[model samples]
Structures are given as C-alpha cells and as structure tokens.
Target: MIVGIDISKKWFDAAWQVDGQGRHQRFEYTDEDIGQLLAQTPEAAHYVMEATGTYHARLALRLHESGRRVSVVNPLVIKRFSQMQLSRVKSDRADAELIRRYGEQQPLSPWAPATDEVLELQQAHGWLNDLIGERTRLLNRREAHAHHAKPNAFVISQMAAQLQQLDGQIKTCERHLEVMVKKSFTELFERLLTIPSIGAKTAIELIIVTDGFRRFEDVKALCAYIGVSPTTFRSGSSVNGKGGIAKLGQGRMRQLLYLCSWTAKTCNPACRALYARLKALGKPPKVINVAIAHKLLRQAFAVATTNAPFSTEYA
Candidate 1:
C-alpha cells in the first residue's frame, strides 16, 4: 500500500487507493489527528509527501518515529511528475492523489532523520544568513538616509545602534555554529579546511548541506545536488545553445560556492590550473568561476571519502 500526503501550514490532505478505488481525508495537525490518519493505513504502507519546508517536517518525523516508511520528495520532482501525467487540478486533494499515484509507480529512497547536532547546525546557519541579510538592508537604508538633504541625527543614531546590535548577534550565532561543528564534526571539518580556498564559512556550509558528507556518494552527485553541474543544449545538430549550469538545486549553496571560487582560482592548485586553461579558451569569468567551484567540490569529496587531509602530492 502507498499513501500520499499534501501538507499545508494548518492542515494536510491524505489519499490512498484501496481495491482500485481512491480514498481521501483532510486533517488538522494535531496528535490525535495524526494518529487517526495513521490508523486508516496499514503498518506496511509507504507514506510519501513533498518536502514543503517546516510544514511537513514534524509530521514526517512523527511518522518515522512510529516506524512508518516515509519519503519526502523534492517539490520540483513532483511538479514535473504532475505535468507528465497531465494533472490539471491544483487543489490540495488533487495534489494528494497525484502524489499517491507518483509513489505507487515511482522509485523513492526511504527518508531518514538527520542527527540532532546537524539539525541544530542547520538552524544556526539559517539564522546567521537571516542576520546578515538584515544587516545589509539596514546598511542600505542608513546610506540612503545619510544622502538626504537634511538627515535626522536621531534617525542616524537609531540605525547605528541597531547595526551594532545586529553585528553582535551575527558574531554570536557564528560562534555557536563553529562550536557545534568542532564538537560534533571536528575531523570532517578540519579535513575540509585543509583544501586551499575552503574557508571556515564554506566548510561549515558544505557540512550543513551535505549532512557531514553522508548524504551523497560521490563528487558528481554532490555537484548535481548543489546545482553546479554543467548542462548543454543541442538538438540534432540543428539547434545549439551555450553551455550553462543546471541551477536546479540549492541556490544559496551555489551562490556561496561561486563567491569562494574567486579565492580558489588564486590559491587552489587544481582550480588555478583549470581556471587558466578555461581562460585561455576565452571562457567568460562567470563560467570560469563556476568550473572552479565544481573543482573545489570534487577535491572536497575526494578528501572526505578517502578519510584523509587534502594533499596535492597524492592528488
């Protein structure tokens, strides 16, 4: 048996098929409601739902704790599947049924909960990003205020105070994240740091995204998950398009990797060689940077899987 679920902020719709007929139900997110939903399905049933941010997290965890099999799929995958099936309806109930059909036919890996430390690290990382964004916005607003014909002293002072507070908070969050990584993932973090141009922030972001490098099996898989893999467009030799990244995965991670590539092209031996080679071929700056980022990921994965520090001599 396969059960499909569509989760929202306040409620969720669940659907399953029995004897070639469909059954559906909607329930609020309460312990009783969740238990009731579980009772309707068999113990061996496979549960599936899209990874809708925090909306599906708690329920998925709860279901897992009850020994139910759950597969949290990427929303993009489900959207593509819907399009292939010619699914025109967009209601929650329709989505639930579509997800049920998808699970019934598609192969899905069983979901596992991330470790407590990793979860905490992910939360801290997100908080730090939010703090940094706030700081940027405040700085821009303050600069705009300062350029006014008659800037208010009181307004400038308030902005300065808020900026100071935000700076302190950001530093505190970063410190917490560092401490957590050191305590829980000291060896992996230190190993990643040995790679040239892989700074503390980049190392931490890599750890958070890859779940300490346990989520992916190889460098290629990691690149694809981070959306840095090269993609090309050509159809029967009649239509040709410039090559570019797929850009289908973690946007934040891709941006961070691109920023790190600037330093990597200078210090990292392999990345530097690749950058120069691509530059001689007249590749654009952005293309070179992305290639360097991809090279860095390959190096990171090599050291991680080998359980050794990065060494150019052996590499």
Candidate 2:
C-alpha cells in the first residue's frame, strides 16, 4: 500500500492505493484528524509528502514516530512530475493523486528528521542571517544620509544606534553558534575549518546547511543540493545550448559558496590551478567561479568524511 499527502498550512489532502485500487480524502491539520486517517492505513503502508516547510514537519514527524515509512520529497521534484500528466486540472485532491502516482513510480529515500542540535543550529543560522541583513540595510541607509547635502542628524544618530545594536546581536549569535558547533559537531567543524578559504562563519553555515554532514551521501549530492553542480541543457539539434548551474537548491548557500570560491581561487593551490586553466580556456568568470565552488565543496566533503584536516598535497 502507498499513501500520498498534499500538505498545507491548515489541512492536508490524502490519496491512497491498495491492490491496484485508489481512494482520495481530506483531513484537518490536527492530531485527531491524523489519527482517524491513519486508522484506515496499513501499518506498513508507505506515506509520501512534499517538503512544505514547517507546515509538514509535525505531521511527518508524527507519522514517522508511529512506525510508518515516510518520504518527504522536494516540491520541485513533485512539480516536475505533475507536469508529465495530460490532465490540466489543479487542486489539492489532484495534487494528492499526483504525489501518490509519483510515490508509486519513483524510488525515494525515506526522510529522517534532524537531531535537536542540528535543528537548533539551523534556527541560529537563520537568526544570524536576519541580523546581517538588518545591519546591511542600516549601513546602506547611513551611507545614503552621508551623501545628502542636508542630512538629518537625528535620523543618522538613530541609524547608528540601530547598527550598533545589530552588530552586538550578530556577535552574540555567532558566539552561541560557535559553541553549539563545537559541542555537537566538534570534529566536523574543525575539519571544515581546515579547508582553504573556509573560515568559521562559512564552516558553520556549511554544517548547518548540510545538517552536520548527515543529509547527503557524497560530494556530488552535496553539490547538487547547494545548487553548485552544473546542469546540462540539450534537446534535439534545434535546441542545443550551453548548460549552467540549476540554481534549484538553497540560494543563500550558493551565494556563500560563490564568495568563498573567490578566495579559494586565489589562495588554494588546487583551486587556483583550476581557475587559471579555465581562464586560459576563455571560460566566463561566473562559470569559473561556480567550478571553483564545486571544487571547494568536494574538498570540504573529503576532509570531513575522512575526519582529517585538509591537505594541499593531496589536492
């Protein structure tokens, strides 16, 4: 038996298949509703749902804890799968059916919830990012005021105070995050820090994004998840074009990797060589930078996996 669920903030639609027969239903976003739905499902039935942020987390966790097989798939993958169908109708029930069909047709890995420490790290990273963005906005506003002929002293003073507060908060968040990483993922964090151009901030961010290196199976999977892997674009002879990175994963992680790649290309011997070769071949800077980012991630993965510090000689 296979079950597919389309999750939303308030409710979820469900579709089930058994003995080549199909059924569809809807339920409220409550424990009672979930219990009622599960009553009809076999204990061994496989449940599939999309990763709809926090909306799906509680239900998925509950289902998993109840000894059900659960697969939380990426929304993009489900969307692409839906596009294959001939029917143009779109609704919650339809989506549930699509997800059910998708689960039936595709081989999907079961989902695993992150550990408490990893979840805490993810939240801390989000707070740090928010503080950084606030600081940037304040700085930009201050800069604009400085350029004005008749700047408002009061506004400028307020902006300065806000910036100072944000800076302090940012520092505190970083310190707390460092302590968490050291306590929960000490060896992995240390190994990542040993990589060229990977500082404490970048290493911590990588750890959080990779769920302390527990999410992906290999360097290639890591690259694809971070949107650093190149994606080919080709059809018949009439639609041939240059391929590029998919940019389908976490955008912030890709941006951070790009920034790190700039430093890696200059400081890391292996990355520098690759950068120079690509430049000599007249590859664009964007393409070269992405390649360097991919290389850096691969190195990070290797050192972390081996529980060893990064070594340039091996590179």
Question: In candidate 1, how many clashes are counted?
Answer: 0
lDDT by residue for model 1 over 176-250, one digit each (tens)? Answer: 998899899899999999999888988888888899889997778899999999998989978898889988887
User: Candidate 2: which stretches are off by over 4 Å?
Assistant: 18-21, 133-161, 235-240
Candidate 2 residues 1-315, lDDT tens each?
779999999999999976777888899999999998789899989999999977999999999899899999999899888887665979999999999999989998998788888888888888898898889888888998899989998998899889889999999999999999999988898888888898887888888898877788888889888888887878988888889987878787788788999999999999999999999999999999999988988998888778789998887
Worst 10 residues of 1 by lDDT: 248-257
Query: Please, what is the TM-score per model?
Result: 0.94, 0.89
**Model 2 clashing residue pairs (backbone):** none
At residue 116, give the lDDT of candidate 2: 88
TM-score, model 2 to reference: 0.89
Report every candidate's CA lDDT: 0.91, 0.89
